[model samples]
Each structure stands twice: as C-alpha cells, then as structure tokens.
Target: MVVIAKQNVVDILLMEAFYEMHQVRDRLNFFQEKYQQTFENFSVFMKKENENFEYFDDYMEWKAYTKLFDEVLKKIEELKNGNFQIALTALR
Candidate 1:
C-alpha cells in the first residue's frame, strides 16, 4: 500500500478528484451508455459527504468525510455511467 502524504491527499480532495472523475467518465463512455445523469447524482453525493467534514480535515477524517471509509458508492456511480470526456476535462 502506498502512503500519500497528508497534505497531498488534501490537495487531491481540493483538486485531484479529476483522476477519479475521469476514471468514471471513461468507463461510462466505453459501453456507449446513457448514464450521464448518474455522474451528476454521484457528484452530488460526494459533495454532501465532503460537506460534513472540513476541507482540510486530517487524512483519516477527510477519508471518513468522503465516505472513503465506506462503500464509495459515488465513485462507483460515476464510473458506472461512463463520461470519460467530462472526467478528463475535470482533471484539466
């Protein structure tokens, strides 16, 4: 397992979710699907979870806030829908 520095992880939360968002978007685009709506929904959920915690909360706390300690259903939902272009754009 790789250990991400606490600070770097925070930066990701603030910005790097693009990678994850792209991962989800790419998977959706692959199947030629119709779930762009799903990504919006999951993004909403992720926002809510993050809202519960501080933006720069400690690593463990931020993970918990993001529900990373839980099922991470939002990420799954986004990935399942497939909209790689959106995900990629988010990264940039």
Candidate 2:
C-alpha cells in the first residue's frame, strides 16, 4: 500500500494543466499568425472567429481548451489558498 497527500495530487494536476494550457496557447498563436490576424484578448479572437465557424473548427476547439485551462487554473488557485490558510492556522 502507498500513501499520497492531497496536495501532491493537486500539484500533479496543476502540472498537467499548465502543460496542456501552454500547448493550446501555442496553437492559438500559430493559427493567429497563420491567418495574419492577432488580437490581444482571447475573447476578441473568439468573436472574430465566430463568423467563420464553418472553416475555423480548430480555432473553436482551441477556444474550448482555453476555457478548460482557465477552469483548471481557478481550481489550482483555490487549492493553493486553502493550503495557505491551513498552514497559517497550524502555525497559530
């Protein structure tokens, strides 16, 4: 039998999420450059692609992956905050 801490699991998840996020980010940048269109904001890019849904499936998939990355990041932040609070309380 083996024991693993919850934080270890969260850390693993965070690592995976970061890797996936970067991959998607690179794809987004590649597509933007390929199309010769750049936007500082993801939402703006999404809006621009909305009109070309029939031809921009890859862009749309990247957008979905971006949203998933955001969700994972939010979970990581929550987990870190919870860990911090636990540490502070233990010290006190």
Candidate 3:
C-alpha cells in the first residue's frame, strides 16, 4: 500500500479536532443546563417535603446534601468566578 501524504494526514487530524471540540462543547452545555434543572427540582422537592426543616439536624441527611451541593455548586461557582480553567481541570 502507498503511504498517505502529510497534508492529507493534517487535514484529517484538523477535521477530527473540530468534531471533537463541537462534541465537548455540546456535552458541556447540556450538563450545565441539566445540573441547574436537577438542583432546582430537588431543592423544590426538599422544601415541599420538609416543611419545618427538622431534617437539618440529622447528620446523615444533612451531610448527604451538603456533600452533594459542595461538589456540584463549587464547580458552578468556580466556573462563574472566571476560574473555568480550574473547573475544567478539576473535571478532568
């Protein structure tokens, strides 16, 4: 078989890079929307389900939500704070 041209290889690699970039951008946007929606939904659920907030005293439940919010909201904050590179690095 004949070897491929360097120019041809570069063209193929460039196309692949653009395609991958589009995919990553789309995926990132999707998760950003989904995360906001899911958090708002569950927040509403929690408020409606727990009228008195008595559950706040429960270490098991409190720690669970605390951990979840810390992980999710921290990244959101970092992204908003112009530390998106850090957030992306952390994501990786």
Candidate 4:
C-alpha cells in the first residue's frame, strides 16, 4: 500500500490544469490567426454577413474553445488558491 500527501495531489491537479490551459490557449490562437480577429469581432462579422457553413462551423468550435479556456483558467486559479476538495480511496 502507498500513501499520497494532500499537497502532492494538489500539485498534480495544478500541473494538469496548467497543461490544459496551455492547450486551450493554443487552440484559441489558431482561430485568431486563421480569421485575423478576436472571437467577439468574428461574431459581429458573422452576424452582419450572410451565413457561410465553414465560417459558422469555425465560429461554433471557436466559441466552445473560448468557453473551455475560461473554465480551465478558473480551475487553475482555484487549484492555486487551495480551494479544491479531494478524496482518495485505496483499492483492494
């Protein structure tokens, strides 16, 4: 049997959260470079113009990535602040 310290668990979670944040930032950057605009500007453009399938698809995907980035950032902040609860159970 092995025991893991609480701080170790928090460290692991923080590492993973940081990795996720990096990945989400990469995705957001991809969309920004591709369209040469921020999501808000792209959204406004989409609303003004006739709908194109590719742009619409990219918009939806970019929107999801944007939301995920925000959520991951929040998770990272919580982990850094020690605001998370965790339970560990041993396996037989």
Off by over 4 Å in 3: 36-92
Candidate 3: C-alpha RMSD after superposition = 12.8
Estimate the TM-score of every prediction.
0.25, 0.53, 0.35, 0.91
Off by over 4 Å in 2: 39-59, 83-92
At residue 25, candidate 2 shows an lDDT of: 76
- Writing each residue's lDDT as its tens digit, candidate 4 over 6-89 gives 889989988998999899999999999999999999999999777599999999999999999999999988888989888666
Q: RMSD of each candidate?
A: 17.4, 7.7, 12.8, 1.3
User: Clashes per prediction?
Assistant: 6, 0, 0, 0
lDDT for 69 (candidate 3): 47
Mark the 10 consecutive residues where model 4 has the least summed lDDT: 83-92
| Local accuracy of candidate 2 as per-residue lDDT tens digits, 41-89 | 5446666665676446756665676677677677667766654332223
Q: Model 3's lDDT to the true fold?
A: 0.49
Best by lDDT: 4
Model 1, 11-69: lDDT tens digits are 54535455555654455453224323443354555566755443233333333434441
Which residue pairs of candidate 1 clash? Answer: 24-79, 25-83, 25-84, 26-84, 28-82, 29-82
Q: Give the TM-score of candidate 3.
A: 0.35
Off by over 4 Å in 1: 1-9, 33-92
How would the candidate models be sorted by TM-score, starting from the highest? 4, 2, 3, 1
Ranking by lDDT: 4, 2, 3, 1
